[model samples]
Target: MRWTVLPLLVLVPLGYVIISAQQSRESGESKQLEAAARHLTFGYYPSSLQQRIYQVPIPYGAAHVGYLETNSWSTSVLYVQFTTTAGGLDTFLAKVGTSRAALRSGSSEISRSQAREASWTFSGPGPWSGTSMHKNGDKPDHAISVDLHDPDAPTVYVVSTVNFRYGFRDS
Candidate 1:
């Protein structure tokens, strides 16, 4: 009876601690849900966690980096913007499975409905290169819009979306 009581006491505390840890982990993943409008964060470079989640690379010497995330019942979006060197820009584009030639000059490839979800405006464009990089039924689709007003430092805008339906669905 004594031994049974000791194991029960220790097991109860261990189970409680495990449950609490699981809750904290889930809560941390959902902090963005608190925002009703937009979950936008800007920095010089994306966090490692974000890089992993979004699978978007921040080229070396990237500046003016911005990351916007939106999630709802059916879709999750990640929009990233940054300014990097021309070579870096090319490398970045290639890594995302596209190239400079694929982008159209003086155009913004991001669809109007998609931009609205990120609370972004792709209008008032200059020398821009834009295109849809990749689309898969089960994987995230990526669209890129580049600002080439300053050829030396191109500002890249990319929208990566995980769509669960046929049409546009946002958070």
Candidate 2:
């Protein structure tokens, strides 16, 4: 009876280990998704706005080349949108593909190539209210703006009141 009980105890512990490993793998995947969403929003701006826009430093790499767009969707509200790409980050699609390929290729196989894309969005203070337009014309690659009245503060209050447009590439 002692010998039989020892085997059963080992099997139960092994089963728990397998289950915990699977859960850990899933949580990691979820974190990757959230990161992808945040990366897509960087340096995006909407078009046809009076405010001056400029590029912010990305730190340690070439700044992403793109446009910015800004528009007042409603009273006391503004919308900014832009699209840019950066290296050193994995996208959601790539993450999924890598996982699938790893399982299919087994332990010895490796991916030969990489992929990237431009993720776009409308991010700003105040309520976002408008139809996002995607037409070809003279527009900033990325767009972002501030709300004049959100009970927090005016968007232009903290910054200098001047129209400024410039670009910088980090090495």
Candidate 3:
């Protein structure tokens, strides 16, 4: 009886230690991924078009952008895109209307379209969510898209296309 009790105590402690280590490792990985996501989304934008094409005002801390992909070997990669509308659509709208009005109206339309697109794309096996939305009173609409996959396969793929109306207020 004495020997049995001593072995049980040792095994239980060992199991606890193993679990604690695993938890810490997972926590660290999560933090790293979050930082990666931020870096990816904040720097992505279409290079072909000049930034002036987007017209709405871009407020500080009011934008987000990123995407993630997983390959068949279970490896994953994340990409982020960022851009601001300074002279494009916003400038055009300011010619005819208040900046605030243009921003709010434009953002409302963009948000609606984004929500619809996200829903349609994720209706199947993949899952997605809109993590943030900032309506700049109708000048420029700011938003973020987040996606994830459980048991992601090596060949799993994900892509995000972001559209911005910069200079124009309506439309």
Candidate 4:
């Protein structure tokens, strides 16, 4: 009886330790999965120039620019902002407009909209693209907006990995 009781005491503690270690390992894996999902799905503000999403090349007679990526809970955005003279902004607009018109004529997937300051919005989807123009009320530079979204993401029980970059042509 004495021998049996001693062995039971050791066995119980050993079992407890094994269970605790397994729980710790599973908890760690769960945390890692959550982080990867956030990196794939979540987006934050693009406050630094180093965190760029893509670049756009202006057609005709304008300068090409690089875009910074940003997101909210439900949307993804690519944006470029630069300081230039009013004449430069006009040139930028004209070039972008010409490009959008070409895209529209070429593809039935494209659609257009109007934004403030004579900006244009064009949207299409193979990998989803949106274009627009903007100016902050106080800022000295005009902004160009383009965004992309994945058509198939997040249905659960399956994982998808998406990698993105832009092909920008020199103007």
Highest-lDDT candidate: 1
> What is the alpha-carbon lDDT of model 2 when measured against the actual structure?
0.29
lDDT of 3 by residue, 1-171 (tens): 999999999999999999999999999996576444422333333222212222322323323433332222322222223222343223423432334333321112224443443332334343433322333423323333322233121011112222343432445
**Residue lDDT tens for model 4, 34-114:** 434422222332223322222232222222232233334533334333333334434444643423232222222312221
Report the number of clashing residue pairs per model: 0, 26, 35, 0
TM-score, per-candidate, Cα-based: 0.70, 0.26, 0.28, 0.25
Off by over 4 Å in 2: 38-148, 152-171
Instruction: Judge candidate 3 against the unseen true structure and give its global Cα lDDT, from 0 to 1.
Output: 0.35
Residue pairs with clashing backbones, model 1? none
Judged by whole-model lDDT over C-alpha atoms, candidate 4 comes out at: 0.33
Q: Regarding TM-score, does 1 or 4 come out ahead?
A: 1
Report clash pairs, candidate 4.
Answer: none
- C-alpha lDDT score of every prediction, in listed order: 0.78, 0.29, 0.35, 0.33
Model 3's C-alpha root-mean-square deviation from the true structure amounts to 17.0
lDDT of 2 by residue, 1-171 (tens): 999999999999999999999999999995565344422333432222333332222222323323222223221112222222322112211321221122211111111110012233223443322111111222222222222223232221011111222222221
Task: Please tell me which predicted candidate would have the highest TM-score against the true structure.
Answer: 1
Pairwise TM-score winner, candidates 1 and 3: 1
**How many angstroms is residue 143 displaced in model 3 relative to the true structure, after the best TM-score fit?**
9.0
Residue 72 alpha-carbon offset, candidate 4, angstroms: 15
Error of 1 at 83 (Å): 0.8
Deviating ranges (above 4 Å) for candidate 1 = 1-39, 165-171
The per-prediction CA RMSD against the true structure, in angstroms, equals: 6.0, 21.3, 17.0, 17.2
